[model samples]
Target: MGNWESRLYSVPPQKLGEFVQNSLRPFEDCQNKIDKTVNTICAVLQEAEQFPLVISVAKGGSYGRKTVLRGNSDGTLVVFASDFEQFQDQTKSPSEILHKIRDVLRVWQLTTELAAQVEVQMVSGTLTIQLSTKRQSITFKVLPAFNALGLSDKPSTWTYLELKRALDQTHSNPGEFSVCFTELQQKFFKNHPRKLKDLILLVKYWYEQCQEKLKYAPLPPVYALELLTVYAWEQGCRTEDFDIVEGIRTVLGLILQQEQLCVYWVINYNFENVTIRNILLSQLRSSRPVILDPADPTNNVSKDKMCWQLLKEEARIWLSSSGLNESPGLSWNVLPAPLYTTPGHLLDKFIKDFLQPNKIFLEQIERAVKIIRTFLQHNCFQHSTTKIQKIVQGGSTAKGTALKNGSDADLVVFPDWLNSYTSQKNERSRVIREIHKQLQACQQKLDLEVKFEISKWKAPRVLSFSLKSKVLNESIDFDVLPAFNVLGHKNSHTAPSPSVYSELIDLYSSSDALGGEFSTCFTELQRNFVISRPTKLKDLIRLVKHWYRQCEKKLKQKGNLPPKYALELLTIYAWEQGSGTTNFNTAEGFRTVLELITKYQQLCIFWTVNYNLEDETMRNFLLTQIQKTRPVILDPAEPTGDVGGGDRWCWHLLAKEATEWMSSLCFKDGTGEPVQAWKVPTVQTPGSCGAGMYPITQEMFSFRICRTLE
Candidate 1:
């Protein structure tokens, strides 16, 4: 077996427990010595003559929490002074306080009886005093704090606000104010069960080994690891007695996901207070690996990306070495980040802030579209018969669901000569080449800078180029695809005649191409399908599209996944089936879509609003399409296209990601219960429809058809 397997087999559970008891635990003698040294330091600080401003001394750090390991001599002493009130304004630096405290310690060491054995010095801006004797030496770090939390275990909102204001103004280290709440920091861990403490010790021991192995390589703070261990136990196994190895395994699993790790506690401060909530939200939204100090909102212990990378690398090795992969379900089911219940208003704000394009961006897009439309209407192609009939804008820009900074427009160019599907398919390539040449040639005449992606294919279908001008912050990309105008100038409210779909089915069946081959022919209909939805429904579509883009970025290296249009259609289906109202809970709608994605194998959704089961040929073709495969999402505008049904795309990867997101905080509410997904079925059946189903036209079939073949 491997090294991890061997190491695990060699150490039985009973033996591991005994090892912790003997090797990791501090002996009574060492404990007594450390306590005596602590008492001596407190006594020296209590001297009123040497330090009149000092009020009281409180123990902090691991020593204060009673979780210190054996032979660890380091400790923190928080000196709260009544006269340091002026420093609370944050106008004065913390070094001034440290210097004042250091001067008093210096005077005492020189005048005290143990002057020969005691050494006082300054280290890293903190006052350090080493008490050395014949047996051993103990080091104490003195930190002067404002004592923000005066006498209560739970401080008031006003008290925290004052502290937050001071912290925000200070130029010093963010954690400098953390000392002010040292008691809360100590109490955060002091109440844990004995078994949980042992888990912390085990994790800390593992961390120490990694630090020794890496030597000079930076790692996240040991305190952050301690908090991570506590968080794991609290979320995974809250009981006092739990399996030690399982706890270790869970922590290691979390460490491996350090890139997305965002953990915090609401015990000390929470989102109820407006000021604190804003601060917490901003902190949570920052770059990953955000481990907020439980006692101090301003401190993020795991902020260094390079350090987290180093720690994650080491964690991968140790986790593999533990030989726990053989045991499934050994680790706890914990998400790296906490669940955030987004209210409707907050989700709306999020869409406006992050997803929706601003006025200026829309204006720029319009200007670019105008210029392109002008060119398509006036410019001539090389072929005498290849005159442009019309150009229609499609895609997210037309549907009003485009995201910020993602600027692109799809301009479907319909040539006059390509009247039939066969002719259009044959002549579209030559038309695209002609357009590409003319676009490059007319840059000077149009007074616009254009850049083209030099295509390697000789018969490219779409001519892709970007337009640059002074009015645009970024170049707007445009895709000019020449297609057959099968619909001509049909009314937006009217569906195409059955003959249109009948012709498409016949042409698609005769060719060796996949479905959606002639989808561009019905661009106007496709745009109208989504553009006419409720405003709130469109917002939901935007949210779903944003999520799909994120998944695309991550899964791009694996292979081609499902198209974003499939997800958009699924969102529309979910909203139609779940709640047809103009306003609904966005999170619920989002959850419903993700839940459907996870069950992609059962998705057989289609909308009969634009096409129906009236015509015999069209009905037979759709029945064949839906029955061909699972995940059959027939394009509303084109019956031949099954956007969700394709063998080339990797649907399983998207399903896997959706499953993980189901457990994320995004799906959870303020009460910590999972936000309920709509009661939408995975497989859309004809019998499942009620009044909420998309309204069918009077000319359509009276009976609904089941997804299964009769």
Candidate 2:
């Protein structure tokens, strides 16, 4: 994305002004938007029961974009994607409680700013300032949506200033702004006035600065936008919302600078078990003559036998939040009792699989946990098992979401009120402590130096964060969420069985049926739902409408619930609505959930890649894809061989034609030529196996990075 950024210096002056006006017009509502945000925040604060939740409220931008109305006591919205299992809460209103989760993780809608005032109000709940409640008829006519769209068809980039001014003038008069904005932008603005205005202004200021900067030297795609958002945070509030805002902010900043920018963001990764995955990647590198058990006719996932309903619940919850009420147990829903640990295991597994190549993953997990544990143990937190979990608890996930050699892990921890304030400053520091310790441990344990982070959220009684490990010779991360334990609840001081933890490790290795009836049910249910979700929103809406209608019809019967109750109940029904008890209240919640869903789809793709009974060539394609370290689509004309010497890429880069020498330098099909096979034994089968192959050797065998994205 950085290299792909544009480097345009400027645009015509009049066009610039036009664009800027378009940017500013809709932002007249800044005061109102800010007021709602603050109000929701303050409201949650007043009745808040948790601390880390408060932290989420404070760190607004980290999640995503919404009208960003408010925060909640639980901070469920920010971490919904990590929640793969259902939570106990059923009555809570997710929409009212937290903004529904969204899809795009990086900020997208804004390039400028939203219209909102910080908000002034009550002593307790009573209003003090007598604010004016008035309206003005402002309209401006400039261009038609069609004309703007037509203009956009040209290869041109406008100035941020032009867009903002255009927006301002438009709001000063909507009649005119409509004429300036492109049909696509207009369509968006008509539906999202706040977001559109925000983008316009962001572009105006940041893009202008980017243009000005280009006069000096080249800049990263997100440089200008990053500067602007960071500048805004420095100016006033550094709300959690800054994270999401920064996302789109950075991209637009780059786009504004240049017009034909082509950057690719990593949408997803593939893997599930942290330990096993790292080991596999390491083996692929160190093991010269890598041998995969081709004799075994087995695929990773058992889709055909899976339970849809249970899978749905697991996918909904675990994928949303990494940490939950309890470490997942076998749910009768999707997996057999022995297959998966719990509904939440889905997300945990996804993270591990996605980052299979990383080396120091486990060390980070333990380190992250220890950081929180040590902090609490050293400070106001008591070591009592029963009380500790309740007062201090949250879950976390980590992988190779790094930028440089030895990057830190995205370790996000959210502690409740009692735990967060228990030691105050040291509370967030505790998570950092864990990250530092774990990195050190990873070095010692895995013989690999590591770097990681522990970011804490600042909200009402909340302390949430993300930690990223450095990428040195390998990629690794530990995104762990440490939750505050339930104080008065029975869970306080409860410790999971040591065997259970080991069992989880074992489960990853073997294909065992953990649960029977329950697992089948869960699997079947999950499958049905996935098979049902159509591509069109209209279709989904229709389904929801029909569901409500059904409930309404039931109301007319003798002992049925009322129509109003039915309406509300339908929405309340978590699993039926697509997301079960997983809390999604903020932009973060929505984004995380959406991401999890996408990952779930990827899992399907992975499964398809590995298993295709109807298609005879699928297994070969998948195996070759694994060996070649690249995606392999089915094509009968081209067949894949065993993965081994294929790992030796770019030999031709250093020497000449490596094709002849490459096979000699390395092994193929677990066998190599004279020079390569001499070290490893040559297969000398009976005359039944006509032998024309030479012995292979491991001598002079080594690995090197032949290519890199940068």
Candidate 3:
């Protein structure tokens, strides 16, 4: 892994070296502008009587380290103050000092001279000043810190002395005060081999380019990448004469591996001190891809594991390129480019040709639903009052997103015998067993000439079975789930009352704490939410599911993938957030969903049509669920159920697929316009437009023709 020549890649070492040099040559003008701005600011602050006495300002970050890119780059100006004790005493906290410094700078910013020198922008508490020249402008974070330089003269009075004490007792970081050690941090990377610095710049360039394309979530900081490059160089054949191409590949390969990367230097900090040692050890063990700050042991820079995974996903794609494969001569694919261009009618045809289900499959699914419903009705428990209340259809079939080749339906039977959700949970296994028995009886009773494919004996939450028709030469699968009729008893015209959710909250709080535990009880609401969507939106949902299925096939995903239901809900959320209309760009909607998949970490989608925030208990629970973590698409029907779950890897795989698919021709048309979204009337009521939420009898299904099939 350390040898670049041993590893297969499309570009020759010479070619890569040239590309690296051409892309990452540092600009001296940008660095000079930053230096001049720091000098001018320091000079002005020293002259201002109202401001704190200025000691000296120094450059920091990439500029200070001499690893900045040629064009627009970020640098930091560390403003050290003489009145450290007074500033610390007067201010409420260390963070307040930054605000105070920014406030003073804001006053100075209004001055014609200062305004002409730089444009001020306040971020979090730090002041960012952008200095403009004829060619370009460079931004710098103006961090004000207490002078800790030459601490040997006043060892007892040094802020670092007190800061170590404060940090030991209370884990509060001294904020930007850490910038006092900026010179040390910059010095750490300053004297590294010129090749190492260039290698770091190349990695930075790749990261920046990938970031533009993969806007999935917040990426790991640039500092982390620099540190990673440094670690790679130090660990792997440490030499100034090493291949730059090898160095770049090693860095990217490390990112792809995503192993626990814990690297730190003992040059500055000592592990001999127990406090520092413990802190360092804990940070080192914090999370995978852990890169502890060499300057500050307490700060583990690689804590954003998801962001690193996104980077890793990109690396994997680059690593898999045929050009990169271990072959003879150099032959790589062209540079990574955007796949889809314009919003046209590609998505419309995708829906019509691939996504939309055929009439025969829909007919088979309808027949299966009726057979299951009739079986549950006939097998009424003699001991119970209401045997089978109603059989509600769900999943892609009910949501109108069922694919033609491989699709499924969920038929949840609400039994009146089960008093509540709790009862259903406790007795679901028994109910499923009875239904399984009755399914065998129904098969004998109907003798419907449909082939019974499998005979699995076990029945847990859902009774599974398969039916195949000789005429159609196809099979349709069903998972018959038995649930309590909580919502069935309510009035159909009006929404369920607050009491319904309040009772649900109590049930959830008292029941098992596992997510999606009570989804069976809310199958009706879930079906209704999907079935109530507009026709075009349903088509969009189908397209997304098709993409998901493609990912599953392409990735050969064996274990539990992120649930298909989550993707359905996500499509609806995208449509609602984008153009919530029947007539919108299909390609745009598809692109939006794919883009959202990349940003699965920030996904917090839920519907309140059936349930609102008016109910306090339900509202609180709902809020808690939404705030849990990334890919949090709360089950609109069952608040406890998070459909976008299983593992982060599930979403990771999908996000990677979305990234690759975004580069395909499927999204474009002849004129190069991206595929357009479907246009249909906004639908009302559940089970309308052949979404089939309500179980249709054989007669109704035969007569109620759907235009989708036509």
State each model's CA lDDT, in order: 0.73, 0.26, 0.64
Q: Could you tell me every candidate's TM-score relative to the true structure?
A: 0.54, 0.22, 0.46
- Writing each residue's lDDT as its tens digit, candidate 2 over 1-710 gives 12212211132222333444453333445435444544443344434443223222221121122211112111111222112111212112333222211111112113323233222222332222111212211111111011222223221222223333443443432122222222222232233334333443434344334435346443332222322332233222323332323323233322222221111110111113333333223333331112111110011111221222232332233222322112222111111111011122122232233223344544654565565455444432333332233222211122112222222332233344324222333354565454344444443233222333333433432333333334222333333334322122432123222332233223322534221111111122122223333222212222233323333332334343222211111222222233332332212222222222222211111112112222223323333343343211111111221111222322112122112122211222222212211111111111111112122222221111111100
Q: In candidate 3, residue 576 scores what lDDT? A: 70
> Which digits, one per residue and each the tens of the lDDT, describe model 3 over residues 322-381?
544343222211111111211235457646743565676567567756765665676545
Q: Which stretches of candidate 3 lie over 4 Å from their true place?
A: 1-344, 379-386, 447-449, 556-560, 646-649, 673-710
- For candidate 3, the clash count comes to 11
TM-score of candidate 1 relative to the true fold = 0.54
| Ten residues in sequence with the least summed lDDT for candidate 2 | 332-341
Query: Quick one: best TM-score, which candidate?
Result: 1
Candidate 3 or 1, higher lDDT: 1
How many collisions per candidate?
A: 2, 198, 11
lDDT (C-alpha) at residue 636 in model 3? 71
Error of 2 at 370 (Å): 4.8
**lDDT of candidate 1 at residue 387, scale 0 to 100:** 68
Q: Local error of candidate 1 at 69, Å?
A: 36
lDDT of model 3, residue 605: 60
Query: Against the correct fold, how does model 2 do in TM-score?
Result: 0.22
